[model samples]
Target chain A: MLAEMIKFEISRLLKRRTLLFWGIVLLIALFTGIIEYLGMGTPKRTVFDAFSFSTSSIMPLLLAPMAGFFTGGALVEDSRSGLLSLIFSKGVSAFEYVTSKAVTSALSQMCFIGITLVVFFVALLPFFPMGSIYIGAQHYSEAFAYNEPVAYCFLIALLFITAAVAFNGIALLTSVWVKNTFVVMAAPTLLYMGLIYVMSMDATKVSLIDPYANLALIDVYIPVSILHMVCYWAVIALITHVLAIAAFSFKKDYM
Target chain B: MNEVLQVKSLTKRVKQKVILQDVNLSVSEGEILGLIGPNGAGKTTLLKIVSGVVRASSGSVWFDKSAGIGIVPEQAALLGDMDALQNLRMLSSIRGKIGTSEIKQTLKRVGLDPDNKKAVRNYSLGMKQRLMLAQAIMEHPKLLLLDEPTNALDPLGIIDLRMLLSELAQAGTGIIIASHLLNEIERMCDRVAIISGGKILRQVNLRSTEQTPIEVTVSTAYDWDILKRWAESVHVELQKLTPNKGLPRGILKTKMAVSQVISELQSAGIAIESISHVGPNLEAVFLEYAQLEGGVYR
Candidate 1:
């Protein structure tokens, strides 16, 4: 039943035209990046430099809001459409319903990020030329000493996936309490942007707790940063998911 | 018959406002129980509690575990983006019984085109009602809960629904219907429960085939005094109808009294114009319970 519910949620999310719209937006951003890189007329660089520039500069801005938009209004939409009553009548437990929604939304965000990464790499393929590997400072050098540029790209994709999952979790939690679609989408994005602002003011200590800040570290020892980001965001996701389950379980009125 | 649903002392209070109070009711297999009430009488809340869509403040609802239940809410609780077939498939899948052919057949049974590809958003109100009915009956549930099921139905749709419900009841599906259509309730329900101020005022057994008092309407060219004297002699209650336009009407407790009045009128050289039995209808019974003063049925 859980698997079927997850499938249903994923199908519902996929049917939203906004998913395709966001995919197009991500492609356009990648296109703009390629055009700008071409205009730079700088010496050719390795694939890792292109991946770093695209992900660090563009991915967060696009993917975070996409994650929020996709997940934020899910519960609210169900309530407004009266589908919540129908679903609950089918004997679905609140825990099962919430977890299925959370997992499905997270996976959908990952898929969106995955598509963006593919678009980034594919768009950069023509621009990749024979040049020195653009490994960053000492930490990046140490991190990628034995790995290739593609490995760095994979690590960057993982970072974006973690950030997407975290943002989706926050959006899901907001949706649980907030009944409006606009508020559901805006609350998490606003919180994420605020955290980014706070981390910018004091990057040293705040970056440890900021998933987006860790996600923006494209030229650093990415494995460790990705690990930290995943752990921090995983905790946030777990907490929000648990709270959402409780709220949904204890709610007496679906209307 | 076996009990399919048992709701015990179900009370629902929302934000300190009492919605339903000590509402106890039950339905046996093959029984149709009509829940009739005025506006804001907690009928929908009770149905929701029984269907598990809303939790009661303090009470228990027990259903036969083996005989699953189906519900059709007041609103069209369906996915607007999906076509009818897709919506039915998704709902059936949740119950772990998904069959495409069965869904199509159900749609056909509900007077919907099985092949229509229009999303539910574009469906008319009547179509939506039919779809809701289709969803409820597709599972062949032992117990069905319907709230205002005939709200958007056309006359033809209503007749079809009435027949369908009657057929389902005969097949042993316990149904709890909450509707304001008193005539529909009178015709289809085996019993009617009148609710007022969040409480059940009375439960009337509509299935009783026992004879009730007959209302007689008589139009004559003779004086009204003649009919009054005849009614007094026959010891039957009689009331004069409006306009006194050559017609005197009265009510009699027995059909025999009606015949006696007609015989007396005939023998009195009165030109009889019309005679008819108005009713011992459910509407009268409903009005009696619905118009009680101060929430107390006198």
Candidate 2:
């Protein structure tokens, strides 16, 4: 039963529509990066610069919330459709059901965003040749970016996917009571914008606890290690996932 | 009869109010148990508790999970996006026990075309009800829990449902049905439980050939004054059904056999224009139980 639940949930989260949605989002980000590069006064922008600029700005702004949108109201929708009761009636325990939802939501978003970032970087490499000398701001780890640009992009992709998983969990948590899909999608996005605002305020008074910067890995705040933010955002996702499971376990699904 | 389920000392309290109190009920193999009660009398709650959708505050419900359990809720518990085949296929994937042929057979049994590719959202209410029934009985469960199974079913669909349930019961499935259709309950159930105030007020065995409630409806142009007096003198329970003077005389229900009721009515000098046999009158019995819950007390 657990295996079947996992199969169906993964199927639910990994629809072709979700893939198309992420594709369109990456295309928009790529075009935006191209337009921004055209407006820049420099002609020596490398492939790494294009990738870094797109990942620096658009990933946290769009992909994380889009991840939330893809799977936010799944459980609540199931509750409203009477599928929850039907599934429970079949003897599938609560633990297995929640586990399947959490696992599939995180795993599907990881696959979507990870593939999008990799594709975006590859798509830009031919357009912008790698230069022997590179200069860019907001790279967070400039030494690592210039020396091992590919590794740097993968690390950023890893952090972005982690944040996307956390945002998805936040959406699922809101799904416990808020059945409206728009609110579920908008909640974590607003939080992301809010955290960025709080982090980008007057630098002297700015707090280092910005979740948005933690994932974006730009404008160093407390210089938290890359591994540390990965664990931190992963823990945030785990906490929300746990809360969603706990709340959903007690949610009365008469539908 | 083999006992398939036993719910002992079951009680459910939501907030401060008690929904179900000491609901001790059992369903035996091949037995159809009908639960009839007024709204808020805990009938649905009892079914939910037994179906494991709701937690009972106190008590234990014992049943063999290996034999399988089928359920039909009041509303359609189906995926609107999926076709009937897809919905059943997903369910079949859970246990991986049955194949497509069995699912198709179950769909056909419930009067639905298995090949129809239309999503359940496009299906009519009756079709949805049929699909719900199909999903429930796909595994040929030993125990079936149905709440308002006749909801949204057309007359033909209702007949098909009755026939299918009868077939399932004959094949040794213990069924518990909660419905407001007293006539259907009388015709389908071997036993009827009248519940009120979250308690089982009475359990009536309707299978007895001799003691089964037999309603004798007599159509007449005349009033029912004489029959009323005769009923009072003999201490037989008489109900003045259809008292609109423009209609029939009345329908008199009694525990007596058909011959006795007709002979007694004829001897009472009542002109019987037309008399028809009817099932036991549960309306008054249900009202009697409802009075206990402050439902019909005047």
RMSD vs true structure, all candidates: 4.5, 3.3
If you assessed candidate 1 against the hidden native complex, which CAPRI class would it receive? acceptable
- How does model 2 fare in lDDT? 0.76
Give lDDT tens digits, candidate 2, residues B1-298. 7899999998888789888888888999999999998787788888887777678889999987877688888888776677999889887777677999999999988989999999888999999999999988998889999998999998899899899999999999999999988878877898889987788888877775554444444555342666777778888867644333455444555656667877887998876555556545566567666665677443
Each model's DockQ?
Answer: 0.46, 0.46
TM-score of each: 0.85, 0.89
What is the per-residue lDDT of model 1 for residues A138-216, given as tens digits with 9 covering 90 to 100? 5643346225556656766777787788778888888877888998888777987887787778656555655543243
Give, for candidate 2 chain A, the lowest lDDT window spanning 10 residues.
Answer: A207-216
List ranges where model 2 is wrong by over 4 Å: A14-19, A131-140, A177-183, A190-207, A211-221, A250-255, B220-222, B241-269, B273-279, B296-298
Residue ranges of candidate 1 with Cα displaced over 4 Å: A36-43, A130-136, A139-148, A197-204, A213-224, B216-256, B260-280, B293-298
Per-model lDDT:
0.76, 0.76
